[model samples]
Target: MPQLNCIAPKPEHGSTSDPVEGGLSLTKMSSESQNKAVLAFPVQPKPLQLPLYPITLKFEEVVYKVKSEQEGFCCGGTWGTKEKTILNGITGVVCPGELLAMLGPSGSGKTTLLCALGGRLSGKLSGKITYNGQPFSGSVKRRTGFVAQDDILYPHLTVTEALFFTALLRLPNSLSRNEKLQHVEQVITELGLTRCRNSMIGGPLVRGISGGEKKRVSIAQEMLINPCLLLLDEPTSGLDSTTAQRILTTIKRLASGGRTIITTIHQPSSRLYHMFDKVVLLSEGSPIYNGPASTALDYFSSIGFSTSMIVNPADHLLDLANGISPDFKHPTEQSENMELEQKSLRENLKSSYEKNISARLKAELYNSEINNYSHTKDASIRSNRKAEQWCTSWWHQFRVLLQRGLRERRYEAFNKLRIFQVISVAVLGGLLWWHTPTSHIEDRIALLFFFSVFWGFYPLYNAVFTFPQERTMLIKERTSGMYRLSSYFLARTFGDLPLELALPTAFVFIIYWMGGLKADPVTFILSLLIVLYTVLVAQSLGLAIGAILMDIKQATTLASVTTLVFLIAGGYYVQQIPPFIVWLKYLSYSYYCYKLLLGVQYSEDDYYECSKGVLCRVADFPAVKSMGLNHLWIDVCIMALMLVGYRLVAYMALHRVQLR
Candidate 1:
C-alpha cells in the first residue's frame, strides 16, 4: 500500500462529519492513496450550538451550620447542641461563559458551597443565592444540572442506554421520545464519547469503559438537558493527568457555549489549572482567594503570599490554605512560632480577601442587581425560558424507569449464581419430598411450610440490598429533579416482578409437580399464585426495612431477624403459644400464606387414610387443624393488605429520605 497520512476530519459547513461506528472517518491526506481510512480516536465534534439560557449564579454571605453536641445549659436549662459553621460567609459569582473552579483540600466545605449554589444543601443555610438575578426557584432548579463527585451510573447500562434513559425521564414532556434520543446523540457526540457509546459502564467486578469515559458519561447525562448552570463536584477525582486534562478541556469548550460551569477540584495539575477561567480558593471553610485563574498568583502575592517559579500555583495555593507558607521547610523551627505564624497567615488572608475581593464582588453584585432590575424585559424573558414544568408525565417516567431497571438488573436477577441457588434448592426439595402420598399429612404440611419459609427469606434478603446499593444513585438523580419519587418507587416496586417472579414461577412449576402435592389445575394454579404473592410481600417488607435504614449491613441484619421471627410464628414450627403472644401468628405473613396454600391444596371434604383403613378429614390432622384452612378469603385479603401495606410503608420511609 502507498504511504498515506491520516488527518482528522473536520466538520463540513459547520455540521458534524458523518459518524461511523466508533467515530467519524479519518480523511487521507496522501495523493498516493485515495481510499479513506477509519481511525478509532475520538474527535470532538464542533461544540453543540444548543439554545443558550444564560445564567448568572451569585451567592452572598452563604453560611452553612450543623449542630454539634456541647455540654451547655441551654434550651430551658437542658444540655443542647451548638451550631458549628461549615461554610463561613462564602461569596462568589460565576457568570455565563465562565468555568469557575472551587479548589480546596478535604473538608474545606468546597462541596458544601457547591451544594448550596446548586440548591442541593439545606441545613441552617443563611445566604442569598440567585440565578439570572432571581432567587433560587423551581425554574432555576429545572435549568441547573449537578454532576456528583462519584459517577452514579448503572454499570450494566451502555453509554447510549444510560443517557437515553436520563433523557427520557429528564427532558421536558413537550419533547417527543425521538427528540429526546436525538439530544442524547448530540451529547454523546459533543463529549466525544461516540467511541464508547455502546460500551458498558463497568463496576468493580464487571469491566466496561475506561475511568475517563465513565466520567464523561456522568457529564453527558447532565448535558442531555442542555443545562445552563452546571455544578460538578470533582469531575476529575480519580482520573490520570491526561484524562483529567481532556476533561477540563471539554469543560472549557462547554463554557464557551455560554453555560456557567462550576466544579469542585481537590488538586489539579498546572496545565489543568490554567484551563479554568476563574478560581475560588477556600481554606477552612473561608475564602482565601477568589479571582481570575491567570491572576490568582498575583492576587496572592499582593496578599503577602508569593510562590517561586518552580512551584505549582495550585500547590502553593493549597499550602497557603493549610496556613503554611509554600517556602516553609525548616524542620528545626519552633512549634509555637509555626502555629502563631500559621494562625496569622489565615487571619491575614481572610481579612485581605474581605477588604479587597469580597467588597468589590459585593459592589459588582449590587450593580448587577440594579442592572437586572432596570432591564425587566430581559429578566422576564429569561424567567420565561427557565419556567419550571413537569419534565415528563408520571406514566412516562414510570415506563422509562421500569424499562431501565429491568435492563440494568437483568444480570443480577438472572446470573448463574442466583439461578443456581434457586435451581439447586428446588431440585433438592423436589427429591426430598418426592411425591409423598396423600396419607402422609404431616409430610405434606411440612413441605408447604418449607415453601413459605424459603420464599420469605429468599426475596427478603435479595430485596433488602436494593435501596442501599442504589441510595447514592437515587440521591444524585432526585437532587437534579429528574423524576418524581413516586414514579421511581412505583417503577421499582413493579419492575422487579417479572424478574423476581420468573425464577419462582419456574421453581413452582418444577417442585410442585415433582413433589406431587396437588394434581388438579385449579389447586396448582392457586398454589402458584399464593407463592408469588408471598414473594411480593417479603420483597416489600425488605424494601421497607432497606428504605428505613438505608444501610446494607443493618438492613440485612434487620431483615434476617424479621424473617426469623416470621418463620418461628408461622404456625409450622410452633402452633400453640401463650395467650399473650398467640397474636404473633396473625402478624406473620408466612402464616397467612401457608394457610392459603393448604386451603387450596386440600378441601374440607378431602380425607386421607390416617390408619390404613380408617378415613379422616385432612383438616382434623394436627398440623392442618392448627393452621385451620377456614376463612381462605380472609387469609388472602390479609396477604393482599400486606402486599400494598408494606410497599406503602416502604414508600413512606423513602419519602422521609431528604432529596435535598
Candidate 2:
C-alpha cells in the first residue's frame, strides 16, 4: 500500500509540468508501507471540477405528446392553423458528463430532445426532466457549456485573442497570464485548431477558418473554465467523414477526461457510431432503446426490428430509427375528398398520432427489457474542480475590462483617429485664429463670436460616428466575458482624452490664426479644453444611446434627431431663440461647448474693446473688453455630470444586454 498525493507531476527534461486538466491530480506517492489518500495536492488548484447543482436525472412515466409543423403564423381569417407532430411521450435520463447521443431522421424528435435537455424546448413539451429526484429548475446554466450548430464567434477577433480574452474574464486572478494562455493553447492543440490559432473566425465577407476550426474555437471558449456538463447541438454537423470523426474523437477525449458530453448526431458513419459509448434510438418522438451502442442490433431485434441481411448493418440499424420510406399510391377510382380529409386530419390531429406512437414505443421497450433483463449503471459522480461564480465583483471586473477596453482601442484605430483629428483641428484652428488686423469694433466682434460658437461642431459629429463601431465590438467581447460595460465606458472616456485635447487644440489654434482672433494663449488653451470636453460628453451620450438600443439603426436615428435639435437650440439663433425654450440653449451640449469656445474666442483675457455680458455687447466690434458669463465652467460641470450620467445609463443597459 502507498499514499496518494495530489501533486504536480515532474516533467521529464525540458517538458513543463503543465497539467491538461487545469487542476491538481491525485497520484500515488510510493513509500514503504500503507496506501491512503492525502488531503494536500501539488497544484495551483485541484484540477477536479464538479457541477454547482449536482443532480441525478430520471425520466419516469413521461408522455410527451409531440407536435407537427413546429412553426406557423396565424392568418387574418382562417378556420384553423397548420400543425405537425415530431414526438410523443418521449423520455430519457442524462446524468452529468454523460454522453447521450440521440439517433433519428431529419423530422424525428432528436433536435427536440436536445433543446429540452437545455431547457429550450418550445411548442408543447409535457415531460418533466427531474434533477436529483426533483423537477429541474434550470439554474445550472453557468455550470454548463452548450455548443450550438453554428459557432458563435466575433469575426474580427483571432482565435488566440478570443480565447485569451475569455480566459482573462472567466478565470480567477490566481490563474496567471501564462497559465491561461497555456490552457488556451492546450485546447487549440488538442482540438487541432493550432494552425488557425491566429486566424479570424471569418464571416459573410471575411474568410478566415474552416467550419470545424470554428466549432473547435467555440468549444475552446466554453471549455476555458472546464464546465460540468457540455450540451452540443450537432457538434459534428456540416463536416466531412474524417472531420466528423476528428470532432467526435475530441468530444470522446473530453468525456474520457471526465467531462460529460451529450450531442445529437444524425446518421453517423459506421466507425463513428461504434465510437459512441451509448445511443438513444428515437422513432417518431418515442425512444425505442437507450443504452450501450454495442448491443444496438439486439435492442432493435428484441423490438421486432430485424435488419435485412442484404442491407449494410449500419444502414440496417439506422433504418430502424429513421423509418422505412415507402411510396403511397392511390387508385384513380378512390375518393379524392376522403383522401384529402385524411391528410387534413393527420395534419390537425398530430398530438393523437404522437401519443399512439409513444404508447407503442413504451410497450416495445418494456417487453424488450423484460425478455433481455437489462441492467442500469450506478450514477457515479466525481468532482475535481469547484464551480466558479458567473457574476464577478464590479471593481476587479472593471479593472480587467478597462484594460481590455484601452488595449482594444488600438483595433478601432481610436488613438490614430484622435491624433489625426486633433492635428487637423489644430491646423484649421491656427488658420482661424491667425492675426486679424481689425480696427473696427463690429467686424472683430463678429469674427470672434463666429469662430468660438462654431468650433464645437466637428467634435460633435466625430464622437457620434465612432461610438457605433466601438459599441459593436464591445458587445461581442462583453458576451464572451471580456469585461464589464461600466469599465469600458470609463476607459473609453479616458482613452479618447489625449485625442480630444488634440482636436480642439488644432481647431482652436487654426481658426484663431486664420481669423486673427488672438488675445491670450493661456485663455485659448482653456477654451480648447471646453470645446473638447463637449465632444467627450457627446460621445459618452452616444455610448449611452448605443447601449440603450439593441442595434445601430435605432441609435443612429436617435443621434441624428439629437444632433439636429442641439444644433438648432444651442443659442445659434442668438437673438430669436424663444424665452420658454431658452433652457434648451443652456441644456444643449453645443451651448456649453459654444460658450466655452467663446470664453477664449479672441485669444486674451484683456479688457474689452467692446462691452461683454451674455451678448458681449460693445459699440466697437473688434475689441470686446468683457468675458461673457457664457456659463462655460457650468457647462464643464454639466458636461462632467452628463458624461457620468450617460455612461452609467449605457453601462446598466449594456450589462443587462437589453435588446430593443
Candidate 3:
C-alpha cells in the first residue's frame, strides 16, 4: 500500500493573513521491501493589490417604511391601507479589506437592507448613510456594484461577447480599447471563468455552462468596472455546497484586495462561515447581533444560550435568533413549552443587545466617524464631479446597442422554429390560392384579402413575445445605468427592420407569382411593397401591446383579439359593416393594404362579366370609387404613417413601464 500526504494552509487565517510555512509528512511502501517516500508541493504567495481609492460605508438609524394595502372580509371584502415598517433603526459600518455577511431567516429584511446600502431601494428611507464621511450620492452609486440574486443576462450571447459588450457600455471612454480588453481578461481570470469565456450563456431550454459558472459570470461582469463596493444577494442560494464554497472563496480573495464586500447568505457551511470578517444577524427586520464573526458564538454563550460541540456555530446562531432549536435533544419536554422558551430567549437576546455593550460601542463609533468628516470642505463636490460624466456618448451607446441588437435578431429570425413557421405559412397560402382566375372577381378578391391578412397575423403574433422575455434583463441593465431606455428601444425596434422585411419579401414574392393576380411588373412590385409595409405596421402594433402589458400570456390574448377585429373590418368579410362600426375598417392597416393591392391591379377600363358573358361591367373603377381608394399613393402614405405611429406609441409605453 502507498500513502500520499499533502500540506495546506489552515482555513482560519488563510483567508485574511499572509502565507506561512507549514509541516508536511508522507510515506510509501513497496511490495517486496520496506521503502518510504515523501513528496512536497510549495504554494507561492501573491500579495493582493489594494484599491486605489478606499471607501468605508456606514449607515445609522436607517428606517424604511412602505404603504401597503390590506384586504379584509368585513363589508364584503373591502380593502384598507396601512403603513408597514420594513427596516427599523439598522446601524452598521463596513470597513475596507473586510468581507461582511448579512445572515437571517426568510423575510428578515436582509435583502432590503442590502438594497438600501446599494442605493436601489425605492421605499421611503430615512437615515444617514455616508461613504468615507460624505452623504451617499450618485457618485457613490456609480462606483458601487450590485449582483442581484438571479442572474439576468442575454442567453443567446456567448460569455466573451456579453462581458465585452458590458465593458464597452460601462467603462469610461478615457480608457482605450486595449485597456478595457485587458481589464475584462483580468477579471475573467480572477473569477476562474477563463475556461468558459467563449461558451454561450444558456437558459432553461439551452445547455451551456453550469449554474455555478453562470453565477461567476454574473460576478465577473460587476468586477470589470473595478468598483469600490460590491454587494451581492444570496450568491449561493441554489448552488451545490462545493460550488458555493468556491464562490465564497473567490469573494474572500476579492475582499483581501481592499474592496468592501457585503453579501446575504443562507445557512453557510462552517468552513464558509469562517471566511467572513463580520456578520450581522437579522431577525424579523431587526438586527439581533452586529459584530465580529469569530466572537458571535462567545457573545451568545455569555448571554445564557449554550451550544454543544456537535452543533454547527452558524446554524446554532440562526436557530437561536429565529426562535427554533432544531438540535435540542430534550425528549420529555412538550413542543409547546419548547416553542415558548425559544420565543422568550429570542426576545431577551434582542432586548439585551439593544441595551448592552455592542449597541453602545456602535453608537460611539458612529458619532466619532460623523465628527471626523464634519470639518472637511468640498468633499462631495470632488466625489460627484467624476460620477456625473457618462461612460460613453449617446452616439456610441446607440452604435454598440445597434450592433448587438442586429446580431441577436439575425440569430432569432433564422431559428429553426421561426424559419419553419414562415416557410410553412408561405407554402400553405400559395397552395391554397394557386393560379387564381382574374375573371372570377369573387375568388380574386378573396385571395388578395388573404394575402394581406396572412402577413399581418404572422408578424404580430411573434412580436408579442419579444419584450416580455427581455424585461428582466432590461430592468437590471437600466438600474445599473448602463444605457438609456430610449436607446435600447430605438435600437431594438429599428435593428429588427432588415430581418422583418426579409421574411415578408420572400413570402410575397412566392405567393404573388403563384397566385397570379396581375401580370404587370409594376403591379407586382406595388403589391409587394404594400404587403411589406402592412407587416411592419402589424409588428409595431405587437410591440406596443407587449410593452403595455409586459406579460406574454396577456399580451398574446390581447393581440389575438385585435388581429381578429382587424381581419373582420378589412372590408372583405362583410363590405357593408353597419356604417356606425365601419370606421374600424379605416383604422385597419390590412384594409388599406387590400385596397391598395386591388387598385394597383385594376384600372378604369378593366371589366368583368357579371353573369357568364351576359353583361360585361366596369367593376374595378366602380369598386375603387365606392370604397374611396382611388388614390393608391394616399393609402401607401397612410400605411407608412401607421407604422411610425405605432412604433412611437410602443416607445412611450416601454419608457413608462421601465421607469415605473
Model 2, span 1-660: residue lDDT tens: 011111212322333322221222222223311122222223323232222222234454444353334343575454544545556656554544456687876766777776666554545666555433333332334445667677766676788877777776766665545555556655666678878887876777677889878888888887776654577878888899888888888888876655556788877888788777667766666565666677767645654446546444456555544433112234567686755654443343234324433455445544433432221111111111322233445676666655654554445444576567656755665554455554334555555445434443454445555556555455434433445566666666666665555555566666655666545677666756666666667767776777666566777788778777776765544535667776666667776665565565543433443333323333223223233444556667887898788778867876666211
Candidate no. 2 TM-score: 0.66
- Rate residue 322 of model 1 by lDDT: 82
TM-score of each: 0.89, 0.66, 0.87
* Backbone clashes in model 3, listed as residue pairs: none
lDDT of 1: 0.81
Native-referenced Cα lDDT, model 3: 0.76
Tell me the tens digit of each residue's lDDT in model 3 across 78-158: 487888888888877787677999998888899999998987787689988877667666666666788999998777788
Cα misplacement distance, residue 145 of candidate 3 (Å): 1.1
lDDT of each: 0.81, 0.57, 0.76
Ranking by TM-score: 1, 3, 2
536 Cα displacement, candidate 2 (Å): 2.1
The list of candidate 3 runs beyond 4 A from truth reads 1-51, 325-343, 371-377, 614-626
Off by over 4 Å in 2: 1-90, 96-98, 101-127, 130-142, 154-157, 198-207, 234-242, 264-325, 328-395, 414-516, 580-583, 602-630, 655-660
Give the candidates in order of lDDT, highest first.
1, 3, 2
Q: Considering only N, C-alpha and C atoms within 3 Å, which residue pairs clash in candidate 1?
A: none
